[model samples]
Target: MKKLALAAGVAVSLVLGVQPGSALAAPTSVVLAASQASWDQKLAVAVKFGLGDDFALVELPDRDFVIGIWDHVKDDPEHVEVRVAAETAFAAAPEDTDQLSYEFIITEVYAAFDRDVERERQEAEAKRQSDLARSAAAASIDVVADAALLNGSDADFVRLIWERVADDAKWPKVKAAARAARDGADSDRTAFIAAGMAAAARQDIDDRIAADEAKTEAEKALERARASKKLAANRIGMPVTDELLNLPDRDFIIRVWNFTPDGSEVQAAAIAATRSLDPVVWKAYIDTGLHAAVERDIQIALERKYQADRALAQQIKATATKNKDLNLVYWTDKALAGTPTQLDDFLRAGQYDLDLSTSFGAGEVLPSWSNTVAWTGGIVNVKPICCTLTGPELGVRNEPGHTGSTSLMYSGLDNNTTKSYAYLKSMALSRITVKSSTRLSYWIYPQSNTVRPEVKPANSTCVAIDLLFSDGKNLRDSLLKDTKGNRAHPAFQCNKVTVGKWNEIVVPLGALAGKKVTTLVVGYDQPGNTGGYRGLIDDIKIAD
Candidate 1:
């Protein structure tokens, strides 16, 4: 019978031109009037008229009707819990007409309203806590900013203020303002400290409230900013302040200290400056002290070099004396007597280039016929039969020479008379041919102890070079001119001879053109006040 009643209800809905069981479908005037009545009135009419199963088809109400009720109460504070519960239930059976019945909806809404109410209370409390945290942070920043305003030049104090709100994510405006103030001009910094910070902080708070951001996230953001700022500052060697504007000065001093030699004056000055831990001291050192110390250090190095060069010069002088290198010995003596620069030059290059040597051989002078002879009066005599007087002995000694290891040395007693003469000569094996362009060149070193003092300075007539030709002619009477315009016999008169230095003599044989040179002689005459006489001769060359 119930099945029959349900079929009958559906049939009646269909005949009325309405979708069966569709409450949204337009209904007849009787059904519309019935739907317009209250839920209680509709129920009473159905029971009184014995509507039976056809009551279901009467289009009592659907999801749209429940949705309307929900909308009305959803925002009502007094019924917030109930509205939330109804919303949950309605949403579950929005399309199921059986589950969306008024009785089921009302029962579910009232039953779970208390749980929703408790949840709402907890959420409100959490929001309150978060608000308090953000407010507290902002208040702390305000206090610091107020303190910073009092001393603008106090970098530490200003830094403290910046640190508090430098990169607060919950306060982006505040962070930006702080950065601008920290890095900007004095006026910008002053403005931020005076009022800009507070305004920016307030803006941040409003932004946070609007976004409903949690306080825990704000704390984490603050920590991240602090870590990032510290890392960046450390990596870049920290930002400069008003007092420490010259950063390069500090770096330069540090490099000097590190790179200079350990016990040096420059290094010492750099160490003292750096260790003082005063920027003023560093600046002073860079400006004045460092340069002064460096100059002193250079002088010290020069002194050390002088000492070393002097020692080396002494060693070279000794070697030159042993080798009879008069040129080397002369330069070494000069270097020792002069400045360190001269000594350094001699040691470095002068010793090798200045020392003279000869290519002439010992075979050119017949050793067996080489002898020394002295004459009482200033007479040119080559024969041994002359006034009997002890002449200086001729020997090869390695004491001083212009060009060779050994020179023909004349040493022994001499008559203390101005007219006395002593000479050493080497007779050639054969008469050597000569051309008009041929010249005789030789170096003479006169010992200071042997030569007369009067002849040692301007001109020395005592020293002479005599050549004997196979034509029975000699240079003493010949009109042959030396490199200087003086005759060959009086060579020392033409050239000034220093006692301790080598003197050169050159005689052009153009006067004896085509003459054959048989003998060569270097002699000292007029031993004015001598007890003994000594001299050296070297580099005997008979070339054109």
Candidate 2:
């Protein structure tokens, strides 16, 4: 079914970010007080503050309500901090007529409020340490003493030592001789003394630098850890207690919540997203805070999912709509369509309808009976059941219209005793007087391994359909490629049977010759193949 749609890209944007002044940006206290108001009112507030997409409900395993905001602002850490602070504060505030009362603030709220503040404090500590390192480097050198050392020292070390001596005016040195001794001592002791000073100073400075680096690094690591933790915590899992991702399984995802004592809002959101996701199994990523201030935000996320699914469905629908010749959407539970198979009905999400519906042999009992439809794509598969033998009739063969050749292989073909008797039945070859534009179509799907007498392959046996027709004498058989019989048409090809969904078979009327008198047959045929290799058949149509 097609839906009246909004641009999918726009809907996705809304889920990713909440605009300024949107409801998501509102002080938690304000939202708590006004939650009783209509959804439109809250949405207006969200848009006003540009926080519509930033907020969502955080469900506790024990079923408690908590609000979560995407407070990761790269350039505006302050704003992020402020929002967290407001949400924390509002949690503690008592509801007033239009806002939360100041006196209602509590210890728990204060603890949450301090979270952002602590982050800032950690960041500030990092900045302070960086500044300290720069200051230490700048203060270590003396310019004037350095200049004197250049002229006085015999070596570069001499200059450095002399500068130290010059700084010590109380040193006992007499005029030129004192300068000479100092200069001489400058070279001799310079290396040893300078090495000692550097070693000593660097010990303390290195420690400070290391501490600062560690603090900054630790803060960054913490931020990353926090984000990873939040992502894990916020994930929406399939509502089913078992593994929902398992392929080829029919399941359902249901989301039940409390929204407006009546739970209507929760129901609406679930219906919308479910229709959009249209998953094989019923899996629900539910926000339990249906009555909370964040319900609207949850709805936004669901709406986004819906729009995405709608866009994809619309594309598939367009293929059908544009091709008016496709008057039907053949539906079936079989993973892949086989020849000689029948098509059932389809479920529409919004618009368009299915003309036929079908169920395969066995295991059809698990289907859902809700007003909604069940279509599992990923999890369901077709498993092949091997040959088995039972007592009785031993072997009996029924062949359709081959005259003597039909009964020739009677003894060669086995019923596999344990399995039901197998036979081929083609539509009676009746001649039509005139060439009419006719469409021959059918739907087919794969069956499960639990089902008996499916294709075993090892015995060169698998279920297949063969369609043969002739306009006068010009004869065309089931797509030669898909037919399991002779290799008359090499170019004709179809996928080898595996676990998958059903597909449709359509032959345009133009493919047939204009001459009258013809024959048509739909049935399974085994050339050299034997044993119980049979395919299921249902709904067959020939329409003009």
Candidate 3:
């Protein structure tokens, strides 16, 4: 009966819109053969009770209703008599037959509860499997993405930079960036690979380039060190150590020469080469040797000097002698001049003969003949070219003159100071130049009016050829003679002359009719005014 009722009960659960008390209508021809039946009989009975194969207690709570199954018998005509008898016995209440019917109902209800619980467990298991599979698949995708990027950078590109190294943990993060670069925006696949590699190796690449450059520079320094040692050895006939090579080329060579015992042509050549590097060192070395070679050089240099000044002192003297160009002989004796006083008094004689005819040069100026300053240590201590000793400065320019390539040029500028003088004073002659009746002749170009007579006079201011006479005496005697009444000299003042054109100014030495002159001075007297005090004086000479 329990089987029969459950079969019919499950079939009624499949019916759409069947309420708790609703009956499933079946055909009157269908019949149940027995009370307790097999599964096949129960199936057939359920079909005959008007139920489909699709029935489940889990989906419909009303499918477990006892009334639904009771309806199976209520609607069946073929089993109506037995169904009626069973119903009357179930309704009478306190008999074993009635309890049997209740037990059947309890079995059906418990069976439905069991089916619903089992169904819930199966559904939960399926969902669990689905969630696990989804997580595993996502992990696989992450691993694949990160591995691809790492492989792009030479297999070893990825590393655990932190102390805690779980490659699996970092995979997702690296994969995210690489995947964005790879599949998101970048169109080129190779770009992803290159970018990954560079990002990984940036620090390493910079360090390598720096190391290579440092190594190359070290190699070059070693090569230079070797070259310096070789140069000192081959050139100076001595070996230079690595320490000495640190010195510059000039200083290094000088150190080597200072130690060299004998200076031969090899040593000389080495020193000469260093002259471009250090002239003072070369001069110290080469100038120490005294031989025919050096004397000949001196004579050749003087031979090219102002033609007339070279006349008498052209040949070097073995001893102090007269009849030489007194000025030339004095300066030429620098090699053996002992002291300046001896050279000045080289001639133990009377006044200088005033051989102005021979004192003037012919044609062109010599490179050796420059009287740009006051004389000292031969002529090397000549004074400034031209000056006013105040506000204005004088410029000296050299061009073709009456005789030589050199001439005196006084640039014009105003001097606001009182008693300002612009003069070019010749160095003291070793001997005196006697001129009393002689005529002082020179070519002059006075471009401005500073030298005209209106400004030049005996007392106030003038532009003149100034002179100083030494009386051919010693320093004290010369100063004493200048202090006493016996001393006398004059300046040949400038007269009215053409502007911008060369004019000859011949001054008769009647003012100094008896004095012998030693120092010849030229340029402006103390004329106070705006001085573009410009002029050129050349071919200065004295003749009877």
Q: Which candidate ranks first by lDDT, i.e. highest?
A: 1
Local distance difference test, candidate 1:
0.49
- Among all windows of ten consecutive residues in candidate 2, which has the lowest summed lDDT? 371-380
Off by over 4 Å in 2: 1-423, 429-437, 453-500, 515-519, 526-531
Q: Which candidate should be chosen as best, given TM-score against the real structure?
A: 1
* Superposition error at 390 for model 3 (Å): 9.9
Which tens-of-lDDT digit does each residue in 339-395 have in candidate 2?
A: 211211111211122222222223221111111101111001111233242211111
lDDT of each prediction vs. the true structure?
A: 0.49, 0.28, 0.36
Model 1, position 250, has a per-residue lDDT of 64
- Tens digits of lDDT, candidate 1, 1-544: 3533443443233223223342221223222111233455334433422443344533445333333344445446555444433333333211222243353344444443543454455446534433332233234243412434332353344455567655556667877777777787765754554346555665665566556545566765443333322221221223324333323556666766766678888789888888887877866775456656755665786687688678767865664343333444556787898877677666554553332224234432323234543111222221222236344455566555676566766544444444445545443212245676777887777665435432233223346667654333456656666786666654334235555677777877776775544345555554343344456677766666
- Minimal lDDT window, size 10, model 1: 374-383
lDDT by residue for model 3 (438-492), tens: 7666676655444533221222113344443321111111211121122112112
Cα displacement (angstroms), candidate 3, residue 465, comes to 1.6
Cα RMSD to the true fold for all candidates = 55.3, 32.2, 61.5
Error (Å) of candidate 2 at residue 278 is 83
Better of 1 and 2 by lDDT: 1
- Report, for all candidates in order, the number of backbone clashes: 0, 43, 12
- Provide TM-scores for the models: 0.29, 0.20, 0.27
